[model samples]
Target: MLAARASDDGALADAATGQSEGGVRWAAFRQGLVTNVLNPKSIVFLVALLPQFLTDRSTWADKSVLGAVTVLMVFVWFCAVSLAVGAFQRVFRRPGARRALNIATGLVLIALALVIVLTG
Candidate 1:
């Protein structure tokens, strides 16, 4: 919802300014948050992974604290990634730069996926 609104608002603003494409400054950050929160598989993985370090006698407060810390870590990491990507946007703005970036990123993703598939 926030992403759609941001995109629409950005598009309108850009159009008024004669800019063809809209900037995703805030939209990308919101997208990272939404993707992290909406992923059920990630939640399940977190639940399964976190409990391995917890004993049966561990209190709810302990789990809550651990979860909060984990979430904080995720927030920090996402912010760092978003900032880095945003900083690189200027370099990718040239003609054919975005296409090259897309191809490179796609290849990296495919390679990572293949590694995961083969390892898992």
Candidate 2:
């Protein structure tokens, strides 16, 4: 049976059960979690944007609820994106599709880097 592997990393999904070899790829999950948590935009949002909705009248409970909701929404968004990508695994496996995706992602990353350099 053909199984799915996310990358050169040992993250594998069984063909029959559609589960990872062991379970959740904790390493990858941790890496992504840390990356997202430390992202400048996320930091800015948390420091600046999140406080915009708060007032002197707001309490710790309100702040906690808002933070929890933000976390939940981000989790849901990432889960949806992961599922969508998994659904198109076969398409992504195609050489043409893979190459196109790689090129597009590379270009975007390069552009982002250039922007950061110029802005900084």
Alpha-carbon lDDT, every model: 0.70, 0.76
Which residue pairs does candidate 2 place in steric collision? Answer: none
| lDDT, candidate 2, at 7 | 54
Model 2 TM-score is 0.66
Task: Name the 10 consecutive residues with the lowest summed lDDT in model 2.
Answer: 1-10
lDDT of 1 by residue, 7-114 (tens): 232223444655445354455456767997999999999978998878999999998899999989988887798789779756655535655556678788889889
User: What local lDDT does model 2 show for residue 90?
Assistant: 84
Best model per TM-score: 2
Least lDDT summed over 10 consecutive residues: which range in candidate 1?
A: 1-10
Q: Give the clash total for candidate 1.
A: 0
TM-scores for every candidate against the unseen true structure: 0.64, 0.66
How many Å off is the CA of 41 in candidate 2? 2.6
Q: Give candidate 2 regions above 4 Å deviation.
A: 1-20, 105-120
Error of 1 at 32 (Å): 3.3
Candidate 2 lDDT over 1-120, as tens digits, reads 022233533224454456664554665577789999889998887888898989999999999999999999999999899889879978886766766676688788889889999999
